[model samples]
Target: MSKVEIYDTTLRDGTQAENFNLQLEDKLKIAQKLDEIGVDYIEGGWPGSNPKDIHFFSRIKNYHFKKAQIVAFGSTHHPQKIPQTDPNLKTLIEAKTEVVTIFGKSWDLHVKDALRISLERNLEIISDSLAYLRSHVKKLFYDAEHFFDGFKDNPEYALATIKKAIEAGADCIIFCDTNGGTLPFELETIISQVKSKFPNISWGIHAHNDAGTAVANSLMAVHLGATQVQGTINGVGERCGNADLCSIIPALKLKMGIDCVTDEQLAKLTSVSRYITELLNIAHPPYLPYVGRSAFAHKGGVHVSAVKRNPQTYEHIPPQKVGNIRRILISELSGKSTILSKAKEWGIDLESEDPEVQKILQELKDLENQGFQFDVAEESFKLRIYKARGELKKHYFRLLTYRVHDYNTLDGRPIAEAEVWVEVKGRERHAISLGMGPVNALDRALRNALEEFYPRLKEMSLIDYRVRVLPETSGTEAKVRVLIESRDKECVWRTVGVSHDILEASLQALLDSIVYKLFLDERREKC
Candidate 1:
């Protein structure tokens, strides 16, 4: 199999996503996770741009990545500015990265318009910066910014820009589908021409999703002999977004027989992708290939039956390879396989052909036909399954009363005070605490209350938390929804809590987090 390099720009590009940003420490944590997951290159950030990014490279030195090279991303050295004085160029030197990637204009329109520079100066910007950066970093990647449009508009100029970078000793010349509007056929043809024009130059592909064709264009680029792939994990970036590395690396590995990422750590890819999203406080892309929760989930009866008969009948790849598993969801359209699968996932030991399976499926269908959606709330789904088979444990933490105080303030800065009383293991206990936020206060009080009875609860903290407000109406009367995530040293679990009162919604989720931990503990004790 051919080897294609996978460069993940999640920290640089993915952070620009809407409501998605990571602090310097968060970036380092995610960078380490990416390294553990075995990516080739990690684009840390444009150190020339943000203070957090500038601090990231320095602080990240406290740790080292084994399987990935940390790459610093920035624009080409400013036109006519001396390389030493240019902050952009200096940032590259300061970042201390082994690889430095800089982009220059390939399109004349950008030269005359955005840069307001002459055409010849643009070529100088490309080659001169690459040559200078080559003297500094071990590897230099030159992104032909807007290369596809440049090729389509002026093929000669685009080819000239790349040839100039090739002459300057760039390790790779990456074609940028910046607008992401190029069809696969057009992208393949343009790339093939570039390959032929610069036969000796190692080529790369970086595509966007403006037209929702980023993944397809990147795949086509690989098919046409591009040796490197540049993208963000989960397809996050400015505007529409960039190509997704999560999809690209697997497509290169499983689909195209290319070894783009580290070999043995493919299973960690799913958790790595998910961990980045969780740290960024963004939801994982639902349909992301190989890593999404719904990637191989089956809801249709025909699909479930076929999957049971022969997994290849419906699955594209085995789900186990990436720390993920196929989910047969129970819905109105679910079959007995769906029920059987859910039973198994919930640890119930019912025969696949048991008549009770059909009855449970019908029951789930009837419930779903009303307003129940078990797929999103698996805790409740487990409860239903356990109850149907007479396997439910009694409630662990029975809520006695919970209260919220709005008047906890020191010198006028107000914070929430939470008081929670619960019946735990047949004993009544009370806990009270204050926090910067209502949910935090509730979580702290609950954990404090249960520490004596459930000491393991002290080790468990809310590592990744989320809140989703689903608006069904306008203004004040809207029904609000909340989702909270809590994790400890080992694993993570999410609980959904919804109410008109935001405090109540958060409290409900906080309650579920404690109960789920206790429930799992009781199960372990039984085992």
Candidate 2:
């Protein structure tokens, strides 16, 4: 087994992906996180490409990294310009990194068509630029631009480019499948030949996912003798995307017998993945490999039954290893496991031998056939189960009826207010409050009515709100689904409500949010 180095380029290549931008602070935070998690190298950014990265490397200069090296990424000295004269090269030097990676044309077509440079001239550019950097830094890496295609088209010239970089004292050689179209078997064969010719030199592999084979090709190259792997977290990059380090790291360390980081904190894999997503405010990849929400989940009745008998029956690996949990969801296809697991999740005890359990499962099936989704609105699902089991306790203030009145303004002012009437423990209570919208008015009115009883509600607030309007007709009347997101000191959750009346949808959504918060308080008190 070889000691495979993991290089993280999320700050660089990842930003190339549409909408994956990180502020200077975000980049620093992610860098610190990668360092904390024991990545071998954190490629800060392409200093030559933009000002943000240049500012980042300078800002992070004083920050300490215990386990990883910070690398500055850029391209080879412009066409034929002198290395020192090129601002691109100057920025790389100013990045304050011990390691720098520069790319040069590896494919013959890129040379003649893309770069429009003679093959021999491109070779000299790679050699002299690398040699210049070698004098400036102790570590230098050369990216063989379009290397795999270059290998297939003109094997001799591509090897010649590698030889130039090696002779120029490049510390590591990385073959970039810039187009991301290479196949696994082809990558293995090319990497084998590169190894045979350059037996004494260390090399890295950077594959993209255009063909959806970046991960496979990366692993194949590693098996064929490459010692270093480079990719981005969550597979963000230009075009199709770069290899996903989240998948590659575990496959190398846990599955392939090679270890990168010694931090048992590797168990926090999914947490780290989610941490990045939260900062980016992007939806977490549900189908992400190794640590996704669905990675260990079993949904179908047959699969759930088998998995319940033995987790290893369907799961490739234990969910806990990657900081994920097995979730058996309740749906039309759910079996008894759904009832038992969901019951366990809600702290409900339903004996397996109980005959009523079957009836409740059937009821769940029927409710699912209705427009109810239990996955996102877990509180609603729990309430149904409790009611079915004769365990539901009504709120101290159960809502009777509510009316929201909104016009341009009360008296030449833009104001909205709501009136609420509710029977709390059989006593009638009423309240009103002004708000930003009809939903806001309703929420405020309800909360003001219950503020004395459930004062803990004040601790939480609605952070975000989303509405999905579904159109049945091509024109006017469209039904809308409102998904409200609320968060307190602990965390945030989403609950959705749908109706043709937008205000009614908003009201239902607001109710879900309040009930969910109350349930959380109750559960925490019990625990």
Candidate 3:
């Protein structure tokens, strides 16, 4: 099997994305995770550009990585200065990383316009920069920035720039699709031509997603004998982002028969992807390939039925191979197979011929018609099954009454206070709390009233709350659906509610969130 090197640039190029910023601590944590997944290189950041990156390099020295070599990214020496005196080159060495990667102008257009240097001078800097860093670092990589576009405009000059870096003792020459407009076929042709010229030199690929084909171009380069693939986790980078290593790694190992990551390292892929997004406070895109939430999720009745018989009927690869599970979505479109499959997953033994399956199916459709979407809130769907099967015998707590008062103080700050009365184990408990909104007040009040009886509820807190107004009705009278995402130490669950009043809808979802947590704890206790 062919071997491919995975170089992660999430800490560097990925931070260039709009609204995507990371602290020094966050970079170190992500680098540790990348190391755990067995990536070949981790580009920490451009130390010459930012103090946070400088701190990341210094602090990261406290711990050691097992497999990944920390890399410092910079540019070729300034046209006005020699490599030995250039501050950028100085910072790269001072970063004390095992590997150093510097990008140089390969496009004559960039040389004349961006760098304002002659083509010959740009080639000279590329050679001088690599030769200076080659002795300072264990491995040195030359990123021919805009190599594809340069090759298209002037193939001879582009190949000449690469030849300079190779002759200067650079370990690898990475062809960068800096503008990300190169198509896969164009990339394949250009790389093929370059390989013919430099047959014995190691080659790498750094592609962007402007043309929506970064992953394709990276894979094509690897197929054409490029050994190194550079990308970011979840493809987070500037513009449309760089090639997604999340997609590339699985394709190389599971699809392309390349030995990049072991099965154990592959299983950590999904968790690692989500962990970075979570730390960045970004919602994990459910549509991402391989490691996304919906990657292996089956929803259509026909798809679900076929997947139950054989997952290969609808899925290309086993989701478990990438550390993702096959999800059977519940909705009006779900067949009895979907319900039985979900029930089986929840450890409930149910047959296709079970009368309760039809009952649950009808209830699901009826609720969906009432603007209740169980697909995103599977915990609510699970409760529906439990109720249909009479497994949920009694209520954990019953709401007696609730009232919310809203007013503005003299300082012109609006505040809401809620008083909640509930019966737990036949004892009435009442609590009052203030919050930023009426719904928040109600959530706080209710939790305050119940936390004494079930302290485990304190472990669970609402992470995300979304309200959607049903389009069937318009204006202030429209029905609303509330989806609440809650999490404890073990796992996260989403529950949904719908009502004519937004506050009532929020209350219903909140109740389901607490009830689900209580039910899970009770079930675990029984086991």
- Candidate of highest lDDT: 3
Shift of residue 367 alpha carbon in model 3, Å: 0.7
* lDDT, candidates in the order shown: 0.80, 0.82, 0.92
Query: What's the lDDT for residue 65 in model 2?
Result: 89
Model 1 misplacement above 4 A:
59-63, 80-85, 94-96, 352-359, 393-518, 525-527
Off by over 4 Å in 3: 525-527
Candidate 1 residue lDDT tens string, 161-253: 988998999988899988878889888788778777777778889999999899999898888778888898788888999998778877777
Query: Model 3: per-residue lDDT, tens digit, 150-269?
Result: 999999999999999999999989999999999999998888899889889998999999999999999999889889999999999998999999999999998899989889999999
lDDT of 2 at 140: 86
- lDDT ranking, best first: 3, 2, 1
What is the TM-score of each predicted model, taking all chains together? 0.80, 0.90, 0.95
Candidate 2: C-alpha lDDT: 0.82
- Candidate 2 deviation (Cα RMSD): 3.2
